[model samples]
Target: MSDHHIIDAKKMMITLEDVNKWYGQFHVLKNINLRVKPGERIVLCGPSGSGKSTTIRCINHLEEHQQGRIVVDGTELNDDLRNIERVRTEVGMVFQHFNLFPHLTVLQNCTLAPCWVRKMPKKEAEELAMHYLKRVRIAEHAHKFPGQLSGGQQQRVAIARSLCMKPKIMLFDEPTSALDPEMVKEVLDTMIGLAEEGMTMLCVTHEMGFARTVADRVILWIAGKSSKKRHRWSSSPHRNQQGPGSFYLR
Candidate 1:
């Protein structure tokens, strides 16, 4: 875990090299270097405030990094508006909170982005929306507004909305963290299906069971940097040894 991993360069889909970020004078990410291969599922586990969310945000340029490089789907991340928009189209993100538009019905919420950002025709966008809604098993709720659905159902719609854009990579920022205990599985099940279909994903979550079962690698972040990464099949006796707030990436 202490040494750098050697991965085949040709297979890489995302690369973050010496990436750093800060909030005012507080350095948040410290020389982060990571490589994700196409179709690889990486689960980032960590305690709260350890920068897992910030790290993922940088990938999609939701939060600007102060230094280093982040390249997603071969596009280098930078301050250019056109490049940022292009990269975003290729990368889909699901937040911890279901950030669906309350005014829009499930179908409209899913269709809006593709129609606007992607310039897809409305009818075609709705068709794409329904396809993913069905994939997430929430097609029957398509006519309901966000507030009309349960937490789990709304989150599924949020996921379907992301999928409607046909992204090459999916980023989940604690997708199940805000759900009720009973509802977590429905969302996770949808994510598992995506993983099984070979979607390249970077998920920031503490769902260890999901990590153990679906992830190709589990990364642990501590004090704003990645400290350990292990293969799914590798045994680590010290996995749960850290303090509650100490943090982990996988």
Candidate 2:
């Protein structure tokens, strides 16, 4: 990565302090605290209903947290519509399913946000969309509709769509869980390449191999709280001396 692309080590990219959330009577997130630096690659791993997805969702204000502070880039997340819009604009999210529009071509799907949200001209948006589609190795399928593509290819297009937004942070919530075993690697490779380019990422995945390959630090979340014990890439993934729990990457 060029020096310009290299993120400042001293600056924090995302911070969550004493974050808490509830759905009816059930508490989903409990006093969650986290700090992420620029260019950092962190993964959130845990069993089902462990609040891994909800945590990332809260960062972008997709699911509002009942209490606690969430600061993204420099803006704090709260009830302010401007703050939420600002955070959403800077943070791009890819869900488990490839949420591509079936009616639109892959190129159109990629260009929609840049054109409508970023207010870029159609020609410029197309160019930008193509740039990212090529990066994800899906430019050839630009004119094809989402339904015409395979699962992996559709996921790659979704990734390209997110990249077109020029987001400061990328969040992946089990991006590969919906794909077949054979197709998982291609998506993971795309993500690895993104990480190489110094994009700050928070991925919620169970892919331990991918985690070991790209993660700077791994955090394990159990129930609603993150474990105090930190695990590195060099550690044996199978052996969790601390106890039984899922491992998250940072």
Candidate 3:
């Protein structure tokens, strides 16, 4: 057990080195460098214009970087399609809008990639799908479509969909920002359960309470470039942090 925890601490899953991103001339991330350990829950907070979401998107190449490099699960993000495909498969992502295939049933949404991309048998893929659905507390909704569920339930299905890919790391871009007040807890509870099960997660959110309670490290991104300087947020010791227009981690 001791060795297990140690392994979790020492395992490095994602590394960003001097990463800079620009939308034409508007530079988003400025020389950003971050290293995340396996099983570490990282929360990123900032104002709306800040590059928090952009940084998370860069990890999965959802938004291609204008400069620097991102490495996930030991493979570098390069021009090679194989490398991109491999990194994407290992790094699962959950969007705020719960981008599900409303036309397909939940079971189809979960098993499609595994059966096609991983080339697993349908029965085997479904077993994995059912396991993750249970993990996210949405097993009973398996046959339903995305439109048939509540926002929170849809998000849970989205999470289960990601887990179907069997990722080594999970990246959440504002997981709960879009839900109603009451639905937030369900999504949070799902995340907490995953944390307890030892999944590595990096999130971009403004929910200070969730960050303080569940995060091992807090990363803050500046709203934009600062006097042409880059601000770096790292994994700090468990200390309470707060700021005016600044991202805090507890």
Give the winner by TM-score: 2
State candidate 2's TM-score: 0.90
Rank order by lDDT, top first? 2, 1, 3
Error of 1 at 236 (Å): 13
lDDT of 2 by residue, 30-137 (tens): 999888989988888888998999999999888999998788997888889999999899999999999999999999999999999999999999999999999999
Distance from true position, residue 141, model 1, in Å?
0.7
Candidate 1 achieves a global lDDT of: 0.85
Deviation from native of the Cα of residue 60 in model 1, angstroms: 0.5
Return the lDDT, model 3, position 244: 23
Q: Clashing residue pairs in candidate 2, if any?
A: 42-250, 43-249, 217-250, 219-248
Q: How does each model score on TM-score?
A: 0.89, 0.90, 0.86
Better of 2 and 3 by lDDT: 2
Candidate 3 structure quality by residue, lDDT tens digits, 75-119: 778788898898899989999999899899999999999999999
lDDT of each: 0.85, 0.86, 0.81
Residue-level lDDT for 61 in candidate 3: 85
